[model samples]
Target: MERSVEMVVALLGIVHAGAAWLPLDPELPAARLAFLIEDADAKVTLTQAQWLSRLPVGHQAWTLDALPQASAFEPISVQANDLAYVLYTSGSTGQPKGVMNEHGALMNRLHWMQDA
Candidate 1:
C-alpha cells in the first residue's frame, strides 16, 4: 500500500483478475480516504495489517500475510474496452474527480510513450 513489492503484485493480481484497480495513497487524509472509498464503492482493499484500522467501516481489508498461497493462476478474459483502472485528479476544484481508463486507451498510451 505504501509503494512496495506487495503493492505491485496486488496491482498485477487485480488486473489479471479482470477487475479495475483504484490505488489510494496511504498518506492521504482520513476524510479523503473515506471519500475515495465511498466514491469508488470499493469492495475489498488490499493493504498491510497495520493499515487495517485506518480503513472505514463496512469495507473488507485483506493483508498480504493472511492471503493463501497459490501455485498457479488462470488469466481472466478481458476486452480492450473493459475498464482497467480509475485515477483521481488532484482535487484542485475541491472534490477529486475519477477518470476511468479502458485497457485499450492505456495500452495505446504506453505504446506511444515507448515510441516517443
Candidate 2:
C-alpha cells in the first residue's frame, strides 16, 4: 500500500501551497527533481532532509510528515476551472505528462448517469 510520492506531493501542493518532487536513485542523483523544480519554477520544494539541504537557496523545504501541519496555514479555494492534477506516467526515461482536469469535467462525468 505504498502511495506514489508524486501523487502525494501534488495533493499536498494543492492543499498546502507547495510543490513535491520525487527523488531519483540508482540512475542519477537529484537529476529529475531538479529539472522538474526548475521547469515548474517551484518556490517551495517538499522533499527529504538530505535533498532539501542540497538544493539551491530560496526554496522552502519540508518533509512529507510535516505537510499536514504546513497545510493548516491557509485554505485554498479551488474554482471550477482550477487545475486538479498533473499526473505523470511511470515510464522508463521518465517522460512526465500533465493531466489537467477541472471541476466541470468531474461534474460532467458524474451527471452522465442521467443520459445512461
Candidate 3:
C-alpha cells in the first residue's frame, strides 16, 4: 500500500513460493479491483491492515504487519517454463487483458539486458 520494504518482501515471498503474483493498483476503482480479483481468482491478497476493508468480500488476505518474523521457507520446485507473473494492460478499448509471462522468458530477458 505504502510502497514500503514490506511490499518488496511480499513480492519476493510470492515468487519464492512458485506462484504468480498479480499487482493491483490501490488507486483503481473498487469495482475494478473486484473485477480483477474475481477474474484472477486470487486466493490471497497481501496488503496493509488499513487497506483490508477495501478488498472485496469473501476474499482471503494477509496483512503485512501480521506476518511472522521468520523469513526462512522451504524452496518450491518450479520449471523454467512455469508462470512467473501476470500483468494487465490498460483497458482503454474495453476490459483489461491479462498477459501471462513465464519464468524462463523473464530470465532470458534479464540475461540479455545484462549481457548487453
Would you estimate the TM-scores of all the predictions? Answer: 0.86, 0.46, 0.86
Predicted candidate 3 versus true structure: per-residue lDDT over 19-97, tens digit per residue? 8888887778889888888888778888889887788988998888786565767788988899988888898999998
Off by over 4 Å in 2: 1-13, 16-28, 53-58, 65-74, 88-116
Ranking by TM-score: 1, 3, 2
- The clash number for model 2 is 0
lDDT of each: 0.86, 0.51, 0.84
Clashing pairs in 3: none
Clashes of each: 0, 0, 0
C-alpha root-mean-square deviation, candidate 1? 2.2
Model 2: per-residue lDDT, tens digit, 1-116? 02466546555555444223333332333555555556555566555544555565565666655654533355556566755434444546566543456655655776997778
Worst 10 residues of 1 by lDDT: 67-76
Q: Any idea what lDDT model 2 has?
A: 0.51
Better of 1 and 2 by lDDT: 1
Q: What TM-score does model 3 achieve against the real structure? A: 0.86
